[model samples]
Target: MLTSSTFSYAIGLILQSIAARRTITSNSIERGLVIRLATDRCYAWGLAAQVAGFLLAFYARETLPVYLVQAAACAAVGVAAVMGAVAFGWRVTRAEAAVLAVLTVALVLLAGAAEPSRVTAVPPATGWVLTALLASCLALAPAAWRARGAVPLAGLAGAAFAVLAVASRPLPALDVTALPLQPLAWLTLAAAAVGQILLAAALQRGSTTSAGSAMDAVTMVAASAAGLALVGDRIADGRTAWLVVGLILVVAGVLAMARVGTVVGEPIRHTDNDVADQPITQGNAR
Candidate 1:
């Protein structure tokens, strides 16, 4: 599930970057609309990939604590950062590289300290799960409405995704035939969709560093708490200190990466000679 989620997210980020580049290079209003249409296609592909990753993650949640799954999922940011650098000329500073390394080490420690999930054959109570999902969304609505910037929006998006993760716990076992019969599954889908929309909006409205970091921190904490309180997830015996340390390191590293702008590239400028050397195109001024 981790591998699948990582691969899918990587693909999604690549597509998103391509779409962004297309949007940047558009020369006129009509051409921009055409470019936007193409970009939408890329965005659709990216969204599909993200959805696939989330679904796999939901399944993994059945056997892993929400914190564990979420922490691992946060690695997607690192993946996306690398992708941006490779495909979009984004540069990673030395500090960002060190932070990424710290994040990797912390995740390893967290994984080692995690207890095996207590698997149950029976699904959780549907009514309470539904109520919780609804109530959480309603509660978060005010904050979402009041949010003023990308960081707040990203934080809200993280909270929404955290709710989605919790809602996924009671889902009927991975049978495609049983999905429609499960209300929790449907709720999970709705929560995921909402979260994705908010995340996209946040990305559009603000810097990836600020928005992404806020989202990551909120999601990690919310998911961890929900897992412990609602799903009966526990840390490995005698590993509480290590777990706490790992969590701190992971969160700090993620924030550091965000602050350093690892996932988005600095704007590139063309030199006069380079511009002059290019052949004239239809969009060029006479």
Candidate 2:
């Protein structure tokens, strides 16, 4: 089932987290830092997982509402934290444990409350608005990075991903041969590139809690509203109150662990000799 894509999302985030954690920081400028992360040997695995998550999300959107899908996206961070504990020996604090539980309840409520609907026609202006949204993300990225704070940069990353979702919304219905002519398809590719870069940058320089929470907050909430108003996403009869409750719990869950931080215990950077002798693999490629 597509609900299983949540696990794929989690695994991808975990791999990407590992890549971001082990990144070498010395002598790298801001732009250079992003490039380094993108090209890091570990990031190749992360990128592959990200591609998987992207495809899974595309399929899942066919049957689920954007709000629910983005909630799963947000919850994927908690799942990654749990994976880190199990696979990487990272310790989980009490607060993180609590957030995980809250996420579980929120997801259940969201899933039960959602009534998936086919979007027959999107207004012409809506598609163009998404294109414009991607453009704004590109134009504002430098200034956003200059702001140097997690909320601004991560928030921008979230907005960019929202564009990715909206652009993807109508694509499942389009003919394969028509994709080249579809503005939404082109926008999807651009949004994915911009969103991936900004998200990696946010995760690398900022706290996991802040980056994940802030980024998903914007995407889950904003994209949900956009889905309802623009893309015809819906709630089941008598499920509105439950949906609201679920979202409130998600808010409470994120707020509970709100603190300044980054992922911990990065391994030491290897010597130049070690780098020169390392064997290359698919993980080494972008």
Q: Best-fitting candidate, measured by lDDT?
A: 2
C-alpha lDDT (0 to 100) for residue 253 of candidate 2? 66
Per-structure clash totals for the candidates = 0, 1
Instruction: Give the number of colliding residue pairs in candidate 2.
Output: 1
What would the TM-score be for candidate 1 when compared with the true structure? 0.77
Please, what is the whole-model Cα lDDT of each candidate in the order they appear?
A: 0.66, 0.71
Alpha-carbon TM-score of each model against the true structure = 0.77, 0.85
Candidate 2 Cα errors over 4 Å, as ranges? 21-29, 255-286
Model 1: runs farther than 4 Å from truth? 17-39, 118-147, 172-174, 267-286
Top-scoring candidate (TM-score): 2
Model 1 per-residue lDDT tens digits across residues 1-286: 7768866866665454333333332121232433353347767787788778877887777677777778877777777777667766677778877877888888888888788674342346633654575567657655654555567657877877887777776562457787787666677777776676566655554555666678888888877777777767779888888788888987887788677754554553334332223321112211
| lDDT at position 60, candidate 2 | 77
* Per-model RMSD to reference: 7.0, 5.3
User: Model 2: how large is the Cα RMSD against the reference?
Assistant: 5.3
Give the per-residue lDDT digits (tens) of candidate 2, residues 201-276: 6666655666667887778777887888888889999999988988777766654544412223223234443343
